[model samples]
Target: MKTIIYCWLFLFIISFNLYSIKISVGEADISLRLTDTDFTIDNYNFDPPIKETYSVEWEAIDNMTYIKFNYTGQAMGEKIARGEKRYLVLFSK
Candidate 1:
């Protein structure tokens, strides 16, 4: 009986840890339990006819997610922007 209960508990813990969740923003999807710290964002609405790719760094603290992003690619054969943006987003499970 004890071995059966231990097996059941192990399965429960494994199943909980294997769960995956994601948050979608526009055309981007972010993982809730992300193993990677960086992601890329692509903007399709550009006036210069070039899509811009932004490199974003993310971190989670407490119940909020912190994000910082900057333009890291060229647009229309030129640099897109020269600024960094930060955001603190609240999420709930």
Candidate 2:
């Protein structure tokens, strides 16, 4: 019984890790975490001059997901911008 529990626990851990995606560029970080019905992306900007945060919500549709994300923290839409500016993403699962 203990061995069976340990095997199940290990498989759960591995499967959970397989669905998470993380990417980092410079001081900005983006991560996508998947759940049963939907997924959420957390965007973090850790730049020295500016620190901002954004969120992306996606819903599953058939074999794909639809996301409309935008960043609200910007320095007057200048050279340095954050997040998606009226952009849409269709992620295929």
Best by lDDT: 1
RMSD of 2: 14.0
- 1-93, model 1: which lDDT tens digit per residue? 000000011111225475233545445554433334444555554555444444556667886666655544456677645556666644344
Give me the displacement of residue 18 in model 1, in angstroms: 7.8
TM-score of candidate 2 on Cα atoms, chains taken together: 0.38
- In model 1, residue pairs whose N, Cα or C atoms come closer than 3 Å (at least 3 residues apart or on different chains), thus clashing, are none
What lDDT does model 1 reach?
Answer: 0.45
Candidate maximizing TM-score: 1
